[model samples]
Target: MEVAEQRSKVVEAYIQAFEDRNAEAVMALYADEATVEDPYGTEPIKGRDAIYAFYQKAMDLNARLSLDGPVRVAGDIAAFPFTVRVTVDGKRQQLEVIDTFRFDRQGKIIEMRAFWGPLNSQEI
Candidate 1:
């Protein structure tokens, strides 16, 4: 399969796992030494264990994720624009984000960076 196509599949699996709230499944798509820098500026979570913990916490919040647009793939990279809906303290909120992933030769995500900010979130 083409690299772009493989990367697209990886991104698809990622979205599916995240929406399913299966942190283990999500972590399976990442490389052993993968790094995730969610929301862009915060400290990056490195390695599978840390990444797993990060996803665990996020999934525990019961957030629902949906694709906002098509997944863009170039070479070994994929960029997914998505929306996350969550209820925090009984207040429903929606966050628009673009997450970019760099995949390894084996199709595992090596790096993930989520782009979003306070302005990207709104009450829903």
Candidate 2:
């Protein structure tokens, strides 16, 4: 398969795993040394363990995800915008964000970044 096609599948699986709240399945999509910079400006979580922890915390929120638009793939990279709705401590929130992934030659994500800020969130 072409690099873009392969990367698209990877992205699809990542999204599905995330929505399913299956941390192991989500971690399977990343390389050992993968880094995730969720929300862009914060320090990136480095390596599989750290990334696993990050996803674990997200899953604990019981957020439901939906695509804001289509996934776009170019070469070994993919980017997609999505929304997450969750209720935490009886407070509902909706997050609108775009996430980008850079895949390694083996098709595992080496880098993932989420683009969102305070203004990107809304109380629901």
Question: Which has the greatest lDDT?
Answer: 1
lDDT of 1 by residue, 1-124 (tens): 9778878888888889988889999988989989999978999989988888888988999888999888899877899899999999999999999999998887888999999998999998
- Residue-level lDDT of model 2, residues 1-124, one tens digit each, is 9787888788788779988899999998999988999978889989888788888988998888888887899877899999989998899999999999998988899999999998999999
Alpha-carbon lDDT, every model = 0.89, 0.89
N/CA/C clash count, model 1: 0
RMSD of each: 1.0, 1.1
The parts of candidate 1 lying over 4 Å away from their true place are none
Q: Where does model 2 exceed 4 Å of error?
A: none
Model 1 TM? 0.95
TM-score for each of the candidates: 0.95, 0.94
